[model samples]
Target: MLHPDLKAQPSRRLPEHGLAEAVALAAALPDLDVVGQDVVRVAKAVPATLFGSGKVEELAAALRAAEVDLVLVDGPVTPVQQRNLEKQWGVKLLDRTGLILEIFADRARTREGVLQVELAALSYQRTRLVRAWTHLERQRGGLGFVGGPGETQIEADRRAIDEQVVRLRRQLDKVVRTRELHRSARRKVPFPIVALVGYTNAGKSSLFNRLTGADVFAKDMLFATLDPTMRAVELPTGFRVILSDTVGFISELPTQLVAAFRATLEEVLEADLILHVRDIAHSETAEQAADVDDILTRLGVDKSVPMLEVWNKIDLLDPAARKSVEDRGAASEGIFPVSVWNEDGLTPLIEAITRHLDEERQHEDLVIPFADGRARAWLHEEGVVEQERVEEDGVHLAVSWTARQKGRFADI
Candidate 1:
């Protein structure tokens, strides 16, 4: 893995940490055995080779000595640059986006996930086809002067990819519609949704398992959980919530992925509460949190929707550090310090969630006309009706519900 630290680059993550993350990303793929990793400082990127020829030769010699089969570049490598690097190093090469796509392809399990991965991969592959063919002017037999063999091949390949993309999109659209129907069903259940989101390997899944008691694929690896998982969880205050565990975020996440996974992330948009879990022990926790927030913003998550910061992995911290973190959390609003593995400080976190939910609830008295049976029934179905009284002109009721539920009732 090589992280090219270009000068004056604006990035949220430190270059060294980015390099480490690149190594972790490379290690996420089971087939690839990472033999070497380094941070390559590039004062300026060469358009053709990314790195200077001398630097490329130096790295090529080192890779040869290490017998590396693949070189994972931790930053963007143009198609031309990738081809040049592969030729110089005499090894297969993958850039940041390509590496991420590979990991997503390997980790996706659901049909929708598979479709999204394929679409994203095809989108990425379409861009690199420029380097796929060698001959650009060799003539091919055609009905007319339609250009050379290379142009024909490129056109045919792109046409094929376009067809595949269209098919995948059709399939994905159907899946998305089905998912939307499911979401609509959940909306009628009166259970608030709480989405867990964070940086990759930040223990979001472990926290999810601890809360919901469902065995999801939780591991100490980057992009461990690609598909979203949800389970109904009853809070301490008897309020039921659907807990959603989503794919983790990363720095410089591929654009294709962000666009492809938008449907998967719609759960976050629909969430009544979002738990921004953080690996509190990681040195780049703040940076990671910022990345998650940035992605959330890009996804158009409503600012009005409440969010809580979860300082997770406290077990890994020393006692003093843990106590300090706890104190910091206590001093702040919407912050909880907890170790999911040790099950420490969970009570407060759960209580905080309950408090946030309760804070959103408003008690009101409504007068529903006797003819409006549907509205009264909805209030009853939502379990927010506290008391009811029959009157000559209408039905008087005392109810408690959140703003969302009230809006839903008004729609009814």
Candidate 2:
């Protein structure tokens, strides 16, 4: 449901354009099956409650009438307010973060993704602990399962939750270790990683499938691609880079989710290049970029790292928009436009990716003695050797590599 925040103030009216953008965002979450919706318009001086008593009553009534199993708030709700509202309404109340987390939980299919979602869920549940267990005041346990040695319900539930949390963490730690091993194997191969990051519904998964020819689950829904998928793509210059499609960013992302997905997002921090794909046709394109950049900054990735902005979804834009995105924004060096659906205007984007990779890589010329053929073979296998010439006593080649790679070659 679109929130009241997107509404234009009537007298001090905002452009009605934002409404369409909000609808687009909502449309992206088709998998949510978001049944019941309520738009609670708070006053200029909104109370800490966000929703007033009157609105709360109306919401409770509507929820009862609709039999909505879930209530999704389009904005952030404090842990205290969330617990209070759930009690007041007698139904599960989920804020934007909770909805996103639920979406992630549903979308996550891989081990890493499952672990990340569990971590995020645990973190979120930790904060709202004060609210969830208060119903345990009347501890009456008369069930035959415990042979009449039944403990108070609240205490029993708390113990169970604590045990589950501990078990979940241990399992997550094992998953993290498994991820590290996979990461190590990739390092042994040592391909430069190019990560696609952008706002949800920006066609990141589409671009990833387009570039790598990998059929990942790409849909119009928000958070559709929760598990990170990587594929090897060969550039025009025969350079094979690993392209990863990560979970999309959104404005006001939950801190719990961020912490939960930190391990997954390490793809961005460790990447050689980032393709900042955007839904250029969206009216809030600028705001979307700001949200993505904000997350990047918090990730502590070097601002100076090379980036290629491949503004996507040109097919949805009008002729005027296409012209503006292609011509009007003469702002940056590597910004290009593409439509992943129709395969429109992708050459420039690919070229920019190649250019960024070339610029970031360090090139060198090295000669290895014939006696050290193992070193020569290792260099050829691991490093990006541009060219090699066989000599009477040695192998000579030009190589472009990372610092770790260069050090390994030097030792050889």
Candidate 3:
């Protein structure tokens, strides 16, 4: 792995740390074994190879010494640079975007997720058509009858890609429409949605499993969970809610993914509550938090939706540091410190979610006709019917429900 620290484009993370992240990203792929890594300091990127010739030579020797089969570049590499680097290093080359695409392709399990990853991968590959097909230089003479010139290999490949992209988009649109219908259906179920979101590998999935009794793939790896998972969970106050576990955010997330996976992230937009889980023990926890917040802003999550910061993985911290974190959380309004592994401080987190949901509750009296048994049953099913009395005109009911439940009841 090579993390090129270009002078013009500075990163929020240290060069060494960035290289470490790239290694971790490579490790996420099961088929690849990471043998060597480095941070290459560059005054400016070489247009052809990204690294200077001397740096390239040095890396080539290192690669040979390490017996590395592939070189992962932790930054964007133009098509020209990618081709040149692979030739000079005599190894397969993958840039950050390509590495991420591979990981997404491996992790996506659902139909929608698989489609999204394919679309994003095609989009990324579309730009590198020159490097993808070596026959771009070959030309074919046109037959006199049909066209002026026969299509080149590059043109044919690009046309094929364009057609595939169109087909995938059409399929993805249908899938997204179906998902929206599902969302509409969930809206009528009278359960508030609480979504868990945070930086990748921040234990969002672990916490989700602990809270919802779900067996979602949870591991200490980046992007352990890709497709969103939802489960019904009851808060301490007897308030039942739908908890959604979504793909985690990361610093410098690929633009292709952000656009392609927007459909999956709609759950976060519709959430009644957002839980921003964090790995409090990580060295760059604050920076990771900022990255997550930035992505949320980019996603246009409603500012009105209540968010609670979960300081997870306290088990990794020392006792004094853990106490400090707990005290800080207590002093704050929307922060909670907990360790999902230890099952510590989860009750308060649940209570906080219940409080946020209950804050929108309103009490109202409604008159229902004797024949409207469905509406009455809905109110009872939602556990919001506080009192009811039968009258000559109709049945009088007093109910306490959140605004969302009231809207659903209104529909009934």
Q: Identify the candidate with maximal TM-score.
A: 3
Question: In candidate 2, how many Å is residue 259 off?
Answer: 0.2
Off by over 4 Å in 3: 131-133, 141-150, 359-412
Tens-place lDDT digits, model 3, residues 183-302:
888766757899999999999999999998989999999999999999998765446899999998888888999999998999899899999999999988998999999999989999
What is the Å distance of residue 291 in model 1 from its true position? 1.1
Clashing residue pairs in all predictions, respectively, total 0, 2, 0
Tens digits of per-residue lDDT for model 2 on 1-412?
4254533343122324433443444455545465644445556423345676877788788878877766666666777677777787887777767777777777789887887788778667655655355665555665665424456655565555667778877887898788789889988857789999999889999998889888988887677788888888878765568999999998778888887788888889999998898999887788889889989998888887788888888888889878888784356677878889999878877877787674356888888787887887776666478889987867888887767667666765
- What's the ranking of the predictions by TM-score, best on top? 3, 1, 2
Shift in Å, residue 256, candidate 1: 0.4
Error of 1 at 211 (Å): 0.8
TM-score for predicted model 1 compared with the true structure: 0.86
lDDT of 1 by residue, 211-305 (tens): 99999999999999999999998776445789999999998888999999999999999889999999999999989988988899889999999
For each candidate, the alpha-carbon lDDT, in order, equals 0.89, 0.75, 0.89
Candidate 3 scores a C-alpha RMSD against the true structure in Å of 3.5
For model 2, the stretches where C-alpha displacement exceeds 4 angstroms are: 2-38, 44-49, 60-69, 83-90, 131-134, 138-162, 329-331, 359-412
The TM-scores, one per candidate, come to: 0.86, 0.76, 0.88
